[model samples]
Target: MGKSGQFIKRWKSLSYDGKVIFLKSAVCLLLIKTGLTLLPFLQFRRLFHRITETSTVKEVSPQQIELTVWAVDTAANLLPFELLCLPRALAAKYLLRKVPSLTLEIGIEVNPAKHFEAHAWVENNGTVIMGKWPESVSYHRLWAWK
Candidate 1:
């Protein structure tokens, strides 16, 4: 069977709640991508903050949160445009329960030739929830936000 057929089959195998979560992830990814593309940096950040703030956070297991994050990350990666770490992290934060202590972190590294480089990632209880945390070790942490 073709990839599209396989995808449909796989999608059909998920439970109703899983499907809903996946759909939400896809929509959030599209919105984040579009907002980043069309709005100024501060405006996009404000909009993103408002959306996340307004989402209803429910009680969910750690494993369920992990699954949601993985699904959202996968969907975000498949988008046509470059989806950066901040949006992906925000999407995970939006889907997770409000009490898990997840943090969005930004780091920077000074390169002798290239001036500097920056990276963003999310962490939960010191464990990396998303982005390249292992690779981020070379970067000096600049700031973090809840």
Candidate 2:
């Protein structure tokens, strides 16, 4: 597995302007997300593989957690109308590729009463980035990592 400290260090090396460029130019993220949702995952990963590499961070594969955060933040800035649905499955799959034997559980639920269903995410390693526990709530899970 890649060293966490090393990953963090690499992530920290980006310049302020460089980060803004990637975030602004991440125009294809919406296409990637939608295409992946429709097409075969491996094919989509091929598209995503490009995205994982399209950052200012050097010496790091597209699979690092920091890279993902970078990419997501950038896309959020660019994709104003996009659903930050949080790309949960994509993140999990990325972790699965990078970290071996990573098993995550997503307790997914939706409530139509509130107009949108909510999804609960939990990593097998017990990381609760989205601990809203939305399993019983009604909010559409745009995409989440469990």
- How well does candidate 2 match the true structure in TM-score terms? 0.40
Off by over 4 Å in 1: 1-10, 54-57, 110-115, 135-137
Candidate 1, backbone clash total: 0
Q: How does candidate 1 fare on TM-score?
A: 0.78
Give the TM-score of each candidate.
0.78, 0.40
What is each predicted model's overall lDDT from 0 to 1? 0.74, 0.46
- Model 1, residue 29: distance off in Å is 0.9
Per-residue lDDT tens digits for candidate 1, residues 1-146, read: 97557657768888888888888888887877788789998998787777666444456777777768867876776667777787787777767637447777888865566667787788887788788655534767788766
RMSD of each: 3.1, 10.1
Tens-digit lDDT track for model 2 on 78-134? 455654433543443343334432333344355444543444343434454323353
- In the predicted model 2, the residue pairs found to clash are 88-143, 88-144, 88-145, 111-138, 116-138, 116-139, 117-138, 117-139, 118-139, 122-146
Q: List the residue pairs that clash in candidate 1.
A: none
